[model samples]
Structure formats: structure tokens, C-alpha cells
Target: MPAEKKAYPLRISPAVLEAMQRWADDDLRSVNAQIEYVLREALRKSGRLKPGQAAPVADDQDDST
Candidate 1:
């Protein structure tokens, strides 16, 4: 089963939104999903999310990006 998701309003600059949209397109994910993916990765890297906790989707690209 999938985890439940909540809806929240977000206010972002147009430039940031445009960048996210492009990145999301490159990743073949919806803009919302891409944002969530990025957030999850950041949280995990910063140790806010414990090991074996909710894992973000795997990113196949090299880290050079």
C-alpha cells in the first residue's frame, strides 16, 4: 500500500517554478512528484529521515548534476 498524501499550498517564485518544471520534465515526473522527490532526498541526506525510513524514489543520474 502507498502512503497517504496531504495537499498544501506552496508559493514559489516564477523562476524557481520554471526550473522545477524543466527538471521534472527531464525526470519524467509530475512537478509535484519531483518536488517531493527532491525534498525526500534532502531530508535523508541531512539525517532528518532515519535509515530504513521512507525512502525516496531511486535517482539513476550521476551525481555531477
Candidate 2:
């Protein structure tokens, strides 16, 4: 069974929201899912989460070039 997800209100700047929207569109994910993916990657990279608890490291793919 999947873990239960909790809902939390997020306050974000319009610019950031717009950027995330664009990225989410490119990745074919909802804005919420994109945000969660980025957050998980950050946590994994920072050693805040165990390797098994988070996704594998994705290849470096910079879209803002």
C-alpha cells in the first residue's frame, strides 16, 4: 500500500509558480507532482532521506540553457 499523503497549503510567488508550471508541462506531470519530485530530489541529494526512501538520482538534465 502507498503511504498516505498529507495536504498542506503552499504560498508561492507568481514567478516561481509560472516556472514550475512550465517545467511540469514539459515533464508531463501536474504542478503538485513536479513540486513533489523536485523536493524529493533535493532531500535525497542533501542526505536528509535514506536512499531507499527516496527516488534514484536522475541524470543531470538542465532545461534552462
lDDT of 1 at 18: 93
lDDT of 2 at 10: 88
Tens digit of lDDT per residue, candidate 1, span 24-60? 8898876777887888888889989877687555434
CA shift at 20, candidate 2, in angstroms? Answer: 0.2
Stretch of 10 with least lDDT, candidate 1: 56-65
Give the range where candidate 2 is weakest over 10 consecutive residues by summed lDDT.
56-65
**What residue pairs clash in candidate 2, if any at all?**
none
Q: Give the per-residue lDDT digits (tens) of candidate 2, residues 1-65.
A: 34456567889999999999999889877777788789998887898977788553232432331
Clashing residue pairs in all predictions, respectively, total: 0, 0
User: Candidate 2: deviation at residue 52, Å?
Assistant: 2.5
TM-score, predicted candidate 1 vs. hidden true structure: 0.78
List TM-score per model, in order: 0.78, 0.78
